[model samples]
Target chain A: MTDLSYTSPRSGSRTANILLRWALYIMLGLFALFYLMPLFVMVITSFKSLDEIRTGDLISLPREVTFDAWRTAWSGACTGIQCEGVRPFFWNSVLIAIPAVLISTLIGALNGYVVAQWRFKGANLFFALMLFGCFIPFQVVLLPMARMLGLMGMAGTIPGLIFVHVIYGLGFTTLFFRNYYVSIPSELTKAAKVDGAGFFRIFWSIFLPLSLPIIVVTVIWQFTQIWNDFLFGVSFSQAGTQPVTVALNNIVNSTTGVKAYNVDMAAAIIAALPTLFVYVVAGKYFVRGLTAGSVKG
Target chain B: MTKWLEEHMPKLVLAPSFIVVLIFVYGFIAWTAWVSLTRSRLLPRYEIDGFIQYDRLFASPRWDTAFTNLFVFGFLFIVIAMILGLILAILLDQNIRTEGAIRTIYLYPMALSMIVTGTAWKWILNPGLGLEATVRGWGFEDFTFNWLVDPDMAIYTVVIAAIWQSSGFVMALFLAGLRSVDQEIIKAAQVDGIPTWRVYTAIIIPAMAPIFLSAFIVLSHLAIKSFDLVIALTGGGPGYATDLPATYMYTMAFSRGDIGQAASSAMIMMMVVFTIVVPYLYSELRTKDD
Candidate 1:
């Protein structure tokens, strides 16, 4: 609360200063309104009836809010092949996100520990190679990966998507843990080493215990990334295996009759719910993960 | 045996991921490079035919539009987002009481998937029933906001949506950069009767150049890889008006079954990424203590 940089504006009278501060508050509030507009529109539209949507203003509260559209979006909205809503795809995303986050986080913690604490030739180079994975355009690997997935007999399946996510996600996850672990002094590992602790022993006893914060950050990052992914989901999965985002896209984009605006908005909010939930619940850690992933140590 | 095991264990644990990166990341890049040079079709042929695919890719008009859209989209999206983000960041750094609440509202868009963003913006920008209609109802009888369906202006609509999604992230980065500024130096400037705006222009903003570059790299990378948003927003619509290289490459490989063009376009995208990223990696790795 006590920011040392706090200073009032000079060169203005008392009334002028008051006016300036009010202007600043109004500007911030207006920007906030701009940022919140799409969300506000989405929520209001999602709760309206089709008649209300057609007959009323684009941005207003529903005449009488209805759960019918949400229910349809969750269970009856149609993609090309079926009208089964987002249930199957939502579960598909859940299946993909949980295991991918866990396995990637596990590998990242170990990889990060060794890269940060243990010294060896080619370690940083290896780490650099892995880190560069985060930056490669996923398009470059699409053809080869598609072929490879087919060759391995995992194409068009959930496991295939998980493998793809974990492979691609390793760079960010490892970077997260490695950055966190580097701040941990090597003396702890050495002190344990003198007491005859082996590599796995020291990591298990020491590093893993100290990794709670980064683990929370990494899990949130990976979960959000994997859950909200659309390109990989659309490219790699078949009809039933599609993630919620892809399913939602199909439902919205494949309209044949009168367009269901309410259903479309409701479907979007549903598809966006998981990451939105994670962000709301643990946003501080989420921001930390994003800033950490980009800003160099 | 125990001593030997202890010494090699770190490498042992890291072997699987290192090997995966070597094959899946580096090895596949090599494979894609070969495919780009081949006369591949539905199935990839292993033989190289010396950039025939690249020739075809450059020849295609869709690829040309996608390529041009990349620049138009990237330049507008990055510049506007930076200006807005920097403005908001500077404002928020004034020790405002509502900084946390405002930052959360601004940055929440970054958490939602691009597809979700596309859906929301698509609806709002729709001509028949969206902003145009809403304004018309309010008695501006001749207002028209039809950019969503207009091929010429569709790409700008994407730029607007893209800016909304990421400008707040740029704000977050800049806010962090602003907070790390030396309080003592700012106080010293204030003591010299340096006006607040002058202090920011001369000292604070210029010092945040690295953060600006960081934001630039992030924004450009997102702009380059943008697919989901465009697909959900415009579907490369009216014609092939809004295709970025990513969507164009997808259409080639999957929709049209021209793996050759897809592979070739992929190589160019990779090259663009390498150009931006290689120098960054070199500088970052060189300066690190490890």
Candidate 2:
């Protein structure tokens, strides 16, 4: 490449470089449209009236924009026996995701601290078992979990769902924190231990302060996961207790009435908004968390 | 007493989660395996009855369709997502001006739940209301893109949505891999007059083989566990034409009240996952230790 550049006059190579750059840009722009088209359709349809949506092509900008579908999707769209819409289910998701994220992150942090700092007998084995939890298909646990929920008398409830999320979430959360903490110097903990610091003391004073970045990653990952979950949301909870994902499914797939395409689109967007907001706000951290969680742990 | 307590606090702090995983993950697995061997129904009955459930599971037509669909969906989803992701990553690696914005657009779909993807695509694929109608409206008069309702092609609709949702994630992984390649080596290759495409094919791509493997492992597991996407898009319909194993297991367990069959199917799904995962885990852990 260098020889060619040196041998050739600068003008011809510059032209070739400009042509290549334009070609790359055009290709990327086309692919970008492919990725954005569904989202464009989703948003455009959501703001149209049902009649307008019916008459218009899928790709057309709405003739008239209205918030009617959004209003109905938020407050009045029927999901089975309930006419109250996805509002309650939205709150249900919030209730479930918050506690689950906090508990999972907290436990993950402590577990990561102990495993990374203490290095007890069988620590690696315990960590491995916990890590294995990350890959087990939720199907493998459904029957027994149902039974366990029944025996515990928490079946079909939000707390039961939280319990399930935390338990399942422990794997990735622990992995994130463990991997993060492992990169912290063991000498810090050693010094703390030498200063008459016990495990909790050293962790709280020393490790916890340094854990903010990982905590953010774990919280965001767990929140997005639990928020977007449908299998557990549908399986573990009944109609009244279902999460936003399940309720959105019920609304969109409900076959008894005239299919409200606009309302369905609105509901879908509503369901996706939280995670979208998180991504837009802290995209860097989210990508970092995703890659770190994926490639390493 | 204090020393003893301090000495034991780590274990004590770790005990709850350990116990939870032990029960919720491992113990439940054992329980599900046992239930598969039993004659459980809408309500679990603890009478251990041999391989009746497995035999029934093997004999069920629905299970067969579900398994076949899993193969098609899993294979197509993984391969297409990997290739597309690699291409997108390579394109982005050209250091184009809009790389960040383009990358973000590609990745945003991953943040949305599968249900959302399904619902959005369901609208776009709806024959009467979506692309078919719109295309026909454009004066073609005979344009039809109705795969969503076509029983034979319904499963591929799922593949489309799944790939759309995940390929960006694969691209991100590959982009990270691409960026980490030693630039000095690339410069040396360039100095030798190796073409840019040849540099990628001969040097960069081969060096990123581990990223490819990791992406494959991730995407395969995701494909196997796909449920919500199918549920939202097709609901395993035009009459169970698109049932993946995960959705099939859900139907048997919850809707059909056939816990025995559900357990058997679930066990089979786990075995599929284990076959892929265990070897990966073993190799990964061994390599880490070394």
Q: Write the per-residue lDDT of candidate 1 for residues A142-209, one digit (tens) a residue.
A: 98899899999999999999999999999999999999999999999999999988888899889888
Error of 1 at B60 (Å): 1.3
Q: Compared with the true structure, what per-residue lDDT tens digits does model 1 show for residues B69-168?
A: 9999999999999999999998887779978999999999999999999999999998999999999999999999999999999999999999999999
Give per-residue CA lDDT, model 2, range A112-165, as digits (tens). Answer: 988888898988898989978899999999988887898899999999999999
Classified by CAPRI criteria, candidate 2 counts as medium
Task: Give every collision pair in model 1.
Answer: none
C-alpha displacement of B50 in model 2, angstroms? 2.8
Top TM-score: which candidate number?
1
Task: Find the candidate with the highest DockQ and give its number.
Answer: 1
Model 1 clash tally?
0
Q: Could you tell me which 10 consecutive residues in candidate 2 chain A have the lowest summed lDDT?
A: A1-10
What TM-score does candidate 2 reach?
0.97
